[model samples]
Structure formats: structure tokens, C-alpha cells
Target: MPYSEPNSATLTPTAIFGGMFNPPHFGHLHPLQDALNLLSLNKLALMPCHIPPHKVTPEVSTEHRLAMLALLCAEDRRFCIEDIEIRSNKTSYTVETLKQLKKRTQSPLWLFMGTDSFNSLRSWHQWQSLIQLCNIFVLKRGREALLHFPEISEYMDCSAKKPLNEAQLLSLHTQTGKVVALETKLLNVSSTQIRNEIRTRNESEAKISEALLPESVLNYIHKHHLYES
Candidate 1:
């Protein structure tokens, strides 16, 4: 796609990638890429948070996280990182973020998530109103559930698609109203696993620790001695 210009119908759907991004790894990138292609998004605005309202994960500092994210996305114009949440609030909430985004740009926005997260839609902050704001794009995680939550298919009424490959990613776009579930390829990586490896440093896990994370993040752990402390 050509570089998007002002006052034109930019097909680039700006999918919101909001998180701590403590040190973004390949795991984060997989869904990001899958979401971009699946939703036909032109670009992704990586939203590194202030404090995630939903979870408490002691990541590197927000500034460092944003800097690393910027570094990671530097090569691609399609992926840009935003620190709006850090600038405004101590805690980041998706409901507020989506509402504020709707107020800012004309680019069509979509919220990207894993199938498990989408299934827990109603439990999020002001989640129903969130659906009205942007379409939900879910990437399948795996055959197993991380949280053993109930079978929920109502909050978004998201249509399901079982895609085994990258090309078959699910897609849906909404301009006027209502929420739709678009399906996409499931990336098989987990942040929890990454954090654990860093903390434990077992010989059996050395391969994953060396491969999955970026050198920058590894250096950060050494500098701050995160997992050690």
C-alpha cells in the first residue's frame, strides 16, 4: 500500500496494539502482523500503557518500553508506537482509550485481541460500549484455554473462522454501528512463558530465553536485574 495522505480514503485500518510492551518480543509481533493483514489495516498504532487496569505485570519502565517499541517498529511505517496513555493517566483502560481515539483521528480503528480475551469481553471496563466504538479482531491462540473461563459467545457475537494458515485470516469492517468478530491466524507464543524463563533461567529453558526475546530486553534485565530481584 502507498503511504497514506491526508484527506483521502485510507484503507489502512489503524489497529490499536495497546499493552505494556515491556520489551516487545516476537510473540507480540505475530498477532500484530496477523491482525494488520487480517483486518486489512494499513497501519498499527502501538499503544504502550501507563498502568493496565486489568492486570499487574511489573515490566520495564513505561519510557523504556515505549522507546524499545519505537525501535522495534522503526523499520516499518505501518507500525507506529504511541505513548498517549503514559502522557495522560497512570492507569490505562481500553474503554477510555477507544473513546478518545474516536475523538482524535478519522482512520477506521479496530481492537485486536486473542480469542480468549475476546471471550472475556463483558468482564472488561465498560466493555459493551467498547464494542459499539470499534470492530473486534481476534486471533486464535490455541486449542487450550489459559484461564479456564466459561464458554462466552455473546458479548460481541463475534463470528468465528478457523484459519490454519496466514492467508485465511478472518476480516470484518463496521462504520455505522454494531460489533463484528473477525477471525485470523493464531500465533503460538505466550508472554507468561517469556516472563517465567527470565525469572527461572533453567538450562532447559536457556534456548527460549536466548531466542524469543530481543537483545535489548535481555540487556534491560541485566541492567535493572528485574527477574533477579
Candidate 2:
């Protein structure tokens, strides 16, 4: 079924950044901060899924992951934690989540995603429904042009021309079913790497003071003894 949002006189520009967030770190935060600044968005939701469809099971428990995200929310006023997917306790499908958001609010929805995920979007369950429900912002890390994966070019706003101006890019939010590329610097880090580092590190020096992770999140991890196995 095609999901359509009701017309509203007032709308808020909101974006959603969803992931396992097994442990939210700087890699997730940097790109999000850039999006918040570039869009001047009112609110950006940080959603953590209970069971990510594409990735392996998370190393930490759902409670631990949400606690870590809460720690982050405490530090930044612009970000908030959305736990619907966690509460579902089922496969986290993007389309279903966006539908729920539309039902909750009339905000113009923008879904932020990395190039790798965008490229493989066709594999997702009900992938086509995703764009119809909300706009997609592909956060490109490098200077290379956005990947023109098969069947995806139709969704890109090719008429707008390359290197879109500020106003042109912002206009995308006014409508749905368009995929636009946004250039931003993303930290070259991954949750898997962080987990490995913690698992292999010397037991006595288990404290990870690395700048890739926030101090509050680190404290929470150490307190819960997460990823030590």
C-alpha cells in the first residue's frame, strides 16, 4: 500500500538518523552535526533499532544501547532518542518506521543515509515505499560523484543539475520521493572496529579514552562492561 501523509498548514523540517547504534560514537555524531547545521533543522531524531535487518546481531543489549544514546541526548539539545523500533522488538524496516512518523507528526521527513546504504537500498524490504513516505539525503563522504546504481537514477532529481545551490537543495524537503546527495565529512570509524578494540585491549586498561567516542558514552560502557566478551 502507498502511504501518504495528510496535508498540514504547518510543518517542521525533521530528519531521522537510524541505526543499530550498538554504541553511538563520533562517526555517527559528526555527520549528524553537519546535517543539523546545513539544514538548520528544528529536530533530528536518533533512532536505535532492536534488530537491524542487514547487520549481524548487536554485541550489547537493547537496554545498554538506548542508555548510551540517552547519554548522547543529554550532551546535545538538538538531538533526541526515538525508540519505536527498539520497542517493536522486531525487524527494523525503514518504510514502516517512516509511516509511523508521518502518523505522529506532519513534519517534512528527511531520511539521512550513508552512500553504502543508499547503494544497497534496493535490497531493503519495501524499499520503494521508503522514498514515497519521505525524502532521502545521501551523505557522501568523498568528492566522487554519487553512485548511479541500477534503478536508482529515476529517483534522483536529475533535472536540478549537479552541485545544487543551497536553495535548490533545501527545496527538496518540500516534496517527497526525491533522492539528493549531500557532501559531508564522515569519521572513518565503525562500531565493529570499536568492539574489536575493546575486546582485544589489555584488561587492566579497559578504559577507552579514544576521541572517536564521547566521554559520557565511554563511562556508560565501562560501567556496564559492554563489548568485553
Candidate 3:
């Protein structure tokens, strides 16, 4: 099915992809694009957090991260940027975002996350309440069993079958508090790698091309003298 921008005309399933996006790159973009296409979502919101609760605080300011994110969204109408966390001026939590979203929209809510994040869900603030707010769609490249995590075994839909595939996910009904493990091809790049490369390489070195970071983002980084420190 072809992609469509989100509209209120229909109560189609919508998704949210939240991250620090310190410097949004292919690793972040690829999985989201794949999800949007595979699931035939109404639209996906690209949220930038003010401060991530689990990882080290991002070195760049929220403004710069949002700016780079804006450049990325400019190319695709399917992805929209939401800076709620950045504007909140506090620690970012998944439950809080979902709560706000729940109050505003009646469409089914889907949260896109990687296996790493899904693994550490218990450690997040009010993690248990997460599944209550939206259905979780975890992205994994391998056929990893979702029930392996003892911490969240209770939340897993064991009877649904193992290693849920693309077809199952596409046809599966969206239920609140249910967990779905999805296999997808994701880029193996990280913001750390991108930052290290930019800091080590000179402008003449075209090693980090549009493949790692969007051309517009690369130019924006250079123009703003980001990651120099």
C-alpha cells in the first residue's frame, strides 16, 4: 500500500518514534521508513527528547537536534517532528508522552522501539504503564524470542506464537498493552560512531557521506560547527 500523510478523517493506526536524535541518521531513519511502509501507518511522529533517562545526556542542544530532525522530515511527508519533550524542560519518559497522546487522539497507538530499549523497559520510569498506553512494536534483525526477558514475560503474548513475522504483524490487531516483536533490516550505525567520525575527519574527507548522515544534515553540522568539542 502506498504511504499517506496522517489525517483525522480516518482513525487509522498511528505510531511514535522518540529518541534524543542528537544527530538523526540512517540508523534512525531506515527502521522508521521501513515500519511506515510495512505497516501502512497513517503517519509517524518523530519525537526528540530533551534528556534521555537511560543514556548519557546528549552533548548537543535540543535546538540543534530538532533542527537536524527538521531537515530530515523536510524530505518525507510521512514523518512529522514533535518537540514536546524538548519543550518540557525535564527528564524524558515514554509513559508521559503516551499519556499526552492518549488524551488527544482516539486512534490506535503504536510505539516503535529497538530490542535494546524493549529489553530495558522495566528500568524506565513507570514502565509497566507503557503497555497500558500503546502497543509496542520492537524491531529486531534476528528471530529473537520476545519471551526471553523474564522481567516483562507477563506482558508478552506467548499464545500468539514466536518470532512474529511481517505478515502476522501487518494483519495483527492493535491491542493496548500487547507486545509484538518485529524483524526488520536496520542500519548498524550509531550517533556515537557518526560523532567520532566527524570529529576525527576534516571537511576534505568525504568518508561520512549522505549514507551515514543526510546531505542537508551534514551541511547543517558544518554550518553550525557542531560536535567540535
Model 2 alpha-carbon miss at residue 198, Å: 0.6
- TM-scores of all models? 0.72, 0.84, 0.82
> Please, what are the lDDT tens digits per residue for candidate 1 over residues 1-229?
1122344243445577676676677677765665565444568787887877777855566666766677667645678877678888556788888878878876556676666676677789887567656655555544533233233222232223432232222223324222334444454556667667768876767666657666666566657666553
On TM-score, the leading prediction is: 2
- Order the candidate numbers by lDDT, best to worst: 2, 3, 1
After superposing all C-alphas onto the true structure, candidate 2 shows an RMSD in angstroms of 4.0
Residue-by-residue lDDT tens digits, candidate 3, 1-69: 112224432566668888878799878877766666556564788898887787888888778998999
**Mind giving the per-residue lDDT tens digits that candidate 2 earns over 62-120?**
88888889887776788998888988967899999998987887777889888888878
Candidate 1 stretches greater than 4 Å from native: 1-11, 57-59, 75-77, 142-187, 202-204
Ten-residue stretch with the least lDDT total in model 1: 162-171
N/CA/C clash count, model 3: 0
Candidate 1 clashing pairs? 12-42, 13-42, 170-183
lDDT for residue 95 in candidate 2, whole number 0-100? 93
